[model samples]
Target: MSGTLALASAIAEMDRDALESLVRRRRPQAPAGVLDPIGLAAELLRPDSILRALSPLDRDALAVLLGLAEEPRAGLARDTDTRTAERVSALLALGLLGVEDARPVALPEVTNALRHALMTAGHRPDDLSTPPPSRSGDNASAPPAAPPSADSWVTAALTAVGQTAECLRVLRDRPARLNRSGSVAVASVRGMAESIGIEADHAAQALAAADRAGLVASGGSSLVVSERAEEWTESDHIARWLDLAATTLATIPAPLRAGLVREEPLAAIAAGLPERFPLLSEAESTAARRFVVAAEYLGLSSHGRLSSVAELLHSGERAAAERLVRDLLPPAAPGVYVQPDLSVIVPGPLAPADEIDLAALTVPEHIGVASTRRVTEASIAEAFSRGITPHQARAAFARVSLTGIPQPLDYLIGSLAERVGNIQVSEHHGDDGRTRIVVGSSELADTLTVDRALQHLQLHRVDPTTLCSRLRADHVLAALADARYHASSPRARASAKAATESTAPPRAQDAHDDLPEALSDLVERVFLAARSEPGTSNFTRRLELAIRDRVPVRVTAEARGQQHTFLLLPVSLSGGRLRATDQAAGVERTLPVNLITAVESA
Candidate 1:
């Protein structure tokens, strides 16, 4: 049995006094292969490992771990007797902590394990949220809260959150996909980040917050809006944002997590923070910076501390909840400015709904007084595809800009709308469970006859009005677009488009309904692509992948009857084994697969 199991057996039945006698007999450090602090964590969290090492601690023993979980980077070293020291030191045997500068530092797993242990012991996690009094200078009696509803920024902030949640609902329902290893595809990440006004790295954190708030959840390869998300919409707007703020705050590690509503600038934490989070990396403290900014934007925070309104709402102060929304958000600019450069200038932050509506038509580029945003043919065409007609879209902008729409944008929007569906594509159901394209347009027929795209389809033009193709709708449409013709699908549903810029917006109650699961499934062939490939690569293939991905790989080799695993970035294949630089040890080593028990990307 492992040394950790042995330790667990030794202390399983021992009381305080019995523990002293047992400890007096022997006290051993963690066995070999457990010394490196990060290595230990990697082993525990690796997909292949079960993490049963921490299964032995009792309620009191778990309480100690819970303490460490609060602030892992700043672990406590309390004075202890021989027996107590032995008890605590036993954790070292499990590779749970490491000494740095002669001090034992806890890893992030402590936090996760502590949560599980706390729940196992029938205790709420809040029991461990109270940190050592000496560590937090803030008052322990009450945590920081947001400003009163009387404040202007408070209401606007909640509106922003409301709009953001709605937009996320749309994106989630469409169900964007992720790559293997759970990283958002670069393009997908960029698009989602832009829509939400956050950095790409923080996009994951924001999505996580939504998940915790029950707004979204993992749905196979993509994230989906949860059924609870409808419940969120039914609740009070400010209350929804307030709940998210508190939950997101809980995600921040202590001593910072205890009270996020503090008035001090967290620039120091953003600059030198060293706590390792499972998702957010330590680059300019992107997660912390984004979290603070999102909170402030949502009015959950004011100045540097929690707003009074946030605290009041959270504390169930419903007395003025109705009137609190007037000044809740930073009031939007009185009016936008229309420019001759095909741009509309916004003087202040737009309401989240207004932002989405405007974003559907124009590309925002500036943020100052009369912030500049351009309206181009491409943007207008995109807006058209989403259900906004050129005239209606221009009218909506004109209403926002007191100065009225400029001649340039008016002409641009018209040109884009006219060009959007010049070539229309539709599918005709066929026998043998396959489908064909029914491409049509008076303007596109001449070009379609001579185009290389239609050459492959062998289109038989029965009339000037239309032509049928054996090629599938997607292929025909893509080909027409590649030939510089604007192709559109009659199948496009613009139901979610806002009524302000569209004639056929769905009713408010029906806006988020009727999502078809297999919208793009009509074709002759349906090849199911795997999200991840099976592990069948040889040494050469693995080395190529290591080079391509540039991530650490776990290499296991046996020595002295114990299997040792090392994290390595493969540099080259050499000497009948892979030559790599050990990321943890910062040294080069060669790993051979013959005696190596396992090798996989970490």
Candidate 2:
């Protein structure tokens, strides 16, 4: 057998990922059907096998080559233009074109791909009178561009990042841990969103971005903040926003992203959308808008839409993000506003340290454009408890307040600090003669009755403020302080290693891996979820077929509390419980058979 025939045989046996990878390589190789041009050409005329590798321009070039298939030249420039010439040369290099009668001719592979594409779109042999499906290019979104004069978008994205991270913390750090899955219970998502005071849809996007960014990841039983979370929290707000935005843009359809990075506008790109994607025109338009949302928030597009800078980020131009921020957020002299209502306002984004310091001493009322903080004596004392001295805390407020710290705030800070540590906890012997927890307050114990922890012990009256729990004096004091009794514990024991042992902090990751792999996994996941007509009779038969064949199927089931569009390959359907493998998570899940409301093709 000819070597070309052997190579073609090997190519035909490869899996989808392997085959696509090989074809996608920048080094275009001789296609499989080189030896028997007639046979190979016939196969190429079939659609799915090769058109997946061709862009619209490549397809158009292939169509031109087809029109001249009967001509005999080694190669054809088509036109003198560089792009046209390059396209023709690419066809030759990819083995899509070969010499026939000494004229450049379409290989069987190209013809087959074109035919397959046409027939897949319902074309008929007798209907060559109309346009071929391969030549129809109305579906793609146009190349995207940003409008001018828009507000900075990075700021909005940063706000989203903050909100997302905090929401993840609420979910993962809760006493009752939430379940973690590729398709987590939407009810849980809604509950967490409610806890964080955001819409479920918004929270879902944030969670997706956070998961993609590697700050939060599945930990088998529950979602947990990964080690990356530490570095994420430490990174500058702008850096965090850029990271999330990169992950978001990475999710755009690859062809669209490719075109954008190559400097195509959305209108131009839009022309190729309808024919390529399953999405409708509105969805295509929304996707184009999606690419611009994060960009506009980053102030990369002052004009209000996607800009060249955003395309740069999508293309892995890391340095472009910094440049965009620097060019857009020019440094301005800091300014402050102090109001009669005892609030401090920063006219713009705060210096990093000042933002943290302010949070420790004030409650934010507003965030964008101008930041407003309402100050109270309790907040001032809270900062002091964190080792910020009264003088230092007052100075921080003064530095950020135009009036140099309001007189009422200053006096309140002093008064609170003076008696802050008065209520104390100590280890003492009760009448029973065992070491127990007791509050040592110079003030009357009647004020301690309001402590929630004390209420848990049913201690309405505080005679020596003793609690019945087995907790340490230090723990008791901290809990009381948290409840605003301002407790301290002088007699609490210290750890033996407290003086000698110094702990190390988390090391930062230089860069994260698994991004491309994870992105691919996500694509496969979406591909596996099927939309179905709601019901059980037909769904049961489909479920059985999938189970018997070991193929993945999506089950849209509504259980008592476990409602979801589930993607799973059934492992068993016994005991009125459907046991299946969740491909996205690579985990086993069991659902009550009765919950299998709908099953659909995947």
Candidate 3:
């Protein structure tokens, strides 16, 4: 009862618009009659509502709030800095702190519920220290970092962009299955790492980030590259990297995000989380650690400091962030040098389309500021198996080559084109439904039959120039292509394309899509209900509430043509009369409810 009275008193001090705004921000639906001061106060004091209000608070604000709650009688110290003043003002606006006798004070019920919840969730009071100043505002500027070269980070960032593209390609080709927990299976993760030429941990982080960026999504039973992934891949390097950084800042858990946007040290975010959020679950702790490594690996941060681009993005200044990061990126190479040694050297980052085209024909040797790739017989054969014609391959290289194609490379392409399609894959006519592979010569047939990579097909040698397998024709052709045998079939290319496209998953519907409208409706209902009712009806309703709880109220009434005031315990209300015992004179009294002019809790 005292908690209700105290909270009601606080709510009464707020203007109607201010009260309605606070009610709307809390995540609960306002029931009918919530416009009453006591009714709204009770709802805001609920434990769930308190927790919802606490979520967006930074560390310093939370520290100040908890300090007020823990030592309510001691009162807060005078605000000496802009940061402290801002925090106190925020708390006051949230209604967590109310002005009482010109000093900030907390509601006992709200504070008690919050402290109990924290304690029950394993938060120890002694373990909580005065939280460090949040890096969210002017304090977000970090100390200057020691460096290698000025452009080293640009090289690092460019390489990460390329790696991300490679990772997306891997997922598109072979969608990974989900485990029981709905995360990518560990074996699939290992395979992805091996395919992308990175360690398993780094690959996992890349996958996590890609999922957050909407480049990857869940298929029915597995994870697949999203439909938007191709467009993202083909976008400019600056847009691609900025998308990753912005998505990461937007979707990561609040604790780690606070560290990032606040410019706190990444390494300390996880360790320092208990001081922010009470305690960290195992899953939260792992995610925080992984995020720390991934942020740096993605070039969004360096050492322990956040990059200026990330800071700008977190502040909702997308254009400024893009400009800052663009200034730091190295220029893209217009063309590559095609040397006679069958090696291509890229002096800088290539445009996305050119990079994709070159990757399709040449094997990457190194990928960095200056990349090196080689054109080999097997590489050309694989490209041919994927349905790239010799003429098309020549045109691709010529288009991106700064120098004319060297004669050695030209001769090699022609010879390799002639060798391709020397083997053909077709369906067998037998009812058993098998595939047949035929070679141009007995020597070629003998080599294909004994090849270790082709052994998985269980190819049975029927003659010097022929072999058969129980697998489908497309499967056999793909295996042969992967083995660099340059086998061709009409259905192979379509099947590969279908396999890639079929893995694109449907977009999941957001569960909270209608939350904003629901909150808006609740606010409107409360405001309308308050406005439509008369003051007499409100006074009568307050008397009914006080009578139901047997609480003392200050009641003013007109009785026998004279105004009288009484401190009374409201006992009952019926027959349009309020029955009560006057507390000051210790006497029973009854007043016509319609004649009661005012009723407020004493």
Candidate 4:
């Protein structure tokens, strides 16, 4: 029967409840006999060929065994036929069955043995109905001793390796004891033989040969592996198999080989390696490349050059194109430049200075003027040409005036002129007592340093009230104020504003209202020191000192059968009864709020 169909048939015959009961009842001291007939039958139904091979039985027999319930001898005889009854009796005689509550019970060890037997049976060929022709001589008394074939040994060894490989993978991380079972090792060997369509005895002999070659270790029930074998298993065993197939394909003539080569890049590489290398065949080189690519993609080795090569290979190049692209891109930097007219300038490696100058000179100038307007305008234009905004220029002007020029007007003009890359000086006569100044900008002198000019005039005893009243009367200040007021009102409402502005520390009396700065600082220091101390005892002592000196003194008093502590601040202590306030509720109560075991200004 086909393996799939046989598996389906076995599954159809399984009784899940009976199988579970069987598994639960059979408690083998060892790992091998964990499953009884029912459990074995269930395993047979699994899609795994190894498991299916482990249980060999007709679907009907499997169904019958899986349906059997745990019962006493009487119940067993009652439920089963004479043949099954005899088998059960024989099993009991063999000490494989136990009596519990006067019931016939299958021991876990026996069940496990039976499971292994069934599994081996399933793996054995169904065509074994016909025996091999007798090799015995014509002598009637001749013994039936026969020698094993070489093919049998080879098949068996391969099976043993395959099965042991699987078990090793499963048990690699588990404790060694879990894999110490001789039966498990034996089962693995049998499974390997089954996988390769061979007999266990031959596979066992082949395993012996491999053991002699130092590829595998056969010690008692366990298998040991040599370093070479360990390395092979850890590395590219799967890729090796693919390479083997590719090598076989490469033996064919070129025209036929081309078809196989087209299946995958590895195959193509394998086919081309011979022409590509003097010592290696095309298939060998392809196999090597395939292995490397697979390893790199799997993240097996960080140093593998496949990623770099793959990029090049994909792009029809011989080197990494992506890395080249990354190298070709320009590096990024912070801090952009701004033109003098308040326009931002994006930094590029190369910028045309002449083009910027032309743009600056062509832009239309603004109207309106002040006493320092000309100097300010020229500074603004110069700053723009130099790729800096008016605001930055103004800040530079302020810094220079603060440090260099004592005469405010001249200082402001000089600073503005410096920002614009201009050094020209202008003398201006204004209404304020023959003021002679070096103006930087003919148009921007007022805009750049108007505030500085007003401050300078005021310092020089200029009558600001009469000048400001005259300007107010002329409607200049009113027009400016109205424009600012209109601009302040926006279409969108702003996010909620803060309730209070940040301020300096309050005095000692205001400490009760809010924690004083000195106390807050002490509290922070004390908390940190307490946390850093070795133990809780040290922490309490430090905390006590900080509280006593910085916080109000509180006396502990028992009231209403509860201990109450109150902080006796001077303001609150005047009254006999303590009135505690709740900050969250914004209410004051007669209850002692300051009566705290832990006392420190918050």
Residue 558 alpha-carbon offset, candidate 3, angstroms: 3.9
Alpha-carbon local distance difference test for all models: 0.51, 0.52, 0.71, 0.32
Summarize candidate 2's per-residue lDDT along 493-582 as a digit string, tens digits.
132122112223222232332224433443233222211122223455456546655788888888567668878999876566788999
Q: Which 10-residue window in model 1 sums to the lowest lDDT?
A: 522-531
In terms of lDDT, which candidate is strongest? 3
- Candidate 1 at residue 505, lDDT? 14
Better of 1 and 3 by TM-score: 3
Scanning candidate 4 in windows of ten residues, the lowest lDDT window is 491-500
TM-score each candidate.
0.46, 0.52, 0.71, 0.14
Q: How does model 1 score by TM-score? A: 0.46
**Per-residue alpha-carbon lDDT of candidate 1 for residues 1-602, written as tens digits (9 for 90 to 100):** 11222222223223443333222222122223332212222334332232333433333344555555566444365424464456467664444444333444455545565576446545576653343222234444665444333464554454455444544644532555656765446777567767544466555545655755656654555555565655665554445665666555445543234234344444333433322211122432465676667666555665545566655554556455434543454455656777888767766655545655676677655433235677767667666655576567977887677778778877777665544544556777653222233333455465566767558767766567577777787887787667655666766433222111222211222212432222112100111110112211333444444654466788788877989889989886545566789989989987664566666668
lDDT, candidate 3, equals 0.71
Clashing pairs in 3: 135-262
Once fitted onto the true fold, the runs of candidate 4 whose alpha carbons sit more than 4 angstroms away are 1-75, 78-86, 89-602
Tens-digit per-residue lDDT, 528-591, candidate 3 = 5344423325466567568656778999998689998999998876677789999899899988
> Scored by Cα lDDT, where does model 1 land?
0.51
RMSD of each: 19.6, 18.5, 7.0, 37.0
Q: Candidate 2: lDDT over CA atoms?
A: 0.52
The number of the candidate with the highest TM-score is 3
Assess candidate 4 and give its TM-score to the true structure: 0.14
- Candidate 4 residues 219-329, lDDT tens each? 333454434333434433222222222222223332222222212333333444332222232454454554443332222212322233233333345234334423432
